[model samples]
Target: MNPFLKPFACHWTMLDNVRVKKAGDIRLKATRSAVIYCTPCGRKLISQAQIDNYLHETKSKLTIELFVFDCKANMKQHYCPDGKILDADISNGQENVPISVVNEVDKEPNK
Candidate 1:
């Protein structure tokens, strides 16, 4: 199997409209193609074009899903040139997934 298309079981994190420093680049701002994965599963950068193709094939633009494995990886920021915030479903099903950042108080327990 191609290294690019490996079976990666993990949660998806969307770097939507995120502006920040890029990787391995001196430039302060960059869309650095990010590799997304479940912090628990495996890590890999899926291809965005591949995901688009899959959605196109299904002929349903209603639910856009990011495949954790295969060619659904993106090059960061959804490559939106029009500066539009494209709302998407980060779920693997017809349901919505809730995500939250850990609070400082929660970290205290680890200390």
Candidate 2:
């Protein structure tokens, strides 16, 4: 398993330890065998990652344009069936802003 890829198993998490294949497909092998529940349906669904690896290889560089244009929809679709949309904090081959701030107020002077 790649050190950079963290294996996560939760009601709101996706499968882990994904590796790239020579045929340009992403393979997801679950580390655990427990049944996971779906957030929307409340039904049990096996934690699996069934998306094709868009990139050619791990060593290949990922460009910003490719991320936004090519891979975004494929990834979203992969999770759509399982109803796992990548959260802001979840960094899964996409650009995510960890923190979101609507507005900031100025501090008052000390009394």
Candidate 3:
């Protein structure tokens, strides 16, 4: 196993959009969705339901850390950009495995 990769567990955080009112009060508003990523690799998970299904099928324990951020876009721009999206394939029936698909942003240039 690679030291940098923790494939068995994931991390999830709630992203909130904040706004400043006229009274100079800061308010935190929850977004429509949250962002889930691999603990070590920072690979983004499609949804909470998908990860739950994958963990259930694989009998793997998940370690979640609740981090609240003001902006979802900032978090995606900084951390999730380095890793590709992780998709769990449960349809195969043999074994449940998480697959990392390479997006255009995650591709490397030819040497």
TM-score per prediction, in order, is 0.20, 0.15, 0.24
- Preferred candidate (lDDT higher): 1 or 2: 1
Worst 10-residue lDDT window for candidate 1 reads 1-10
Tens digits of per-residue lDDT for model 3, 1-111: 322123332443332354444343546656434333332334334445655665566576542222222234453333334654344443445646644444446455323
For the record, the alpha-carbon RMSD of candidate 2 to the native fold, in angstroms, is 17.2
Which numbered prediction scores highest in lDDT against the true structure? 3
- Flag regions of model 2 displaced more than 4 Å: 1-35, 49-111
Deviation from native of the Cα of residue 55 in model 3, angstroms: 0.7
**lDDT per residue (tens digit) for residues 1-111 in model 2:** 222112222222333344434343556655432322232224323323311122233232432222211212223333222222224344444555453222223333222
Q: Rank the candidates by TM-score, best first.
A: 3, 1, 2
Indicate the worst ten consecutive residues by lDDT in candidate 3.
63-72
Candidate 2: what lDDT?
A: 0.30
Residue 68 lDDT in candidate 1: 40
Instruction: Rate residue 101 of model 2 by lDDT.
Output: 24
- Overall local distance difference test of candidate 1: 0.36
- For candidate 3, the lDDT comes to 0.41
Q: How many residue pairs clash (N, CA or C atoms closer than 3 angstroms) in each of the candidate models, in the order given?
A: 3, 1, 0
Model 2 CA lDDT for position 92: 47
lDDT of 1 by residue, 1-111 (tens): 322223222233433322324442223234433433322223222355545554476574322342443224443323323332223333435566733223333323222
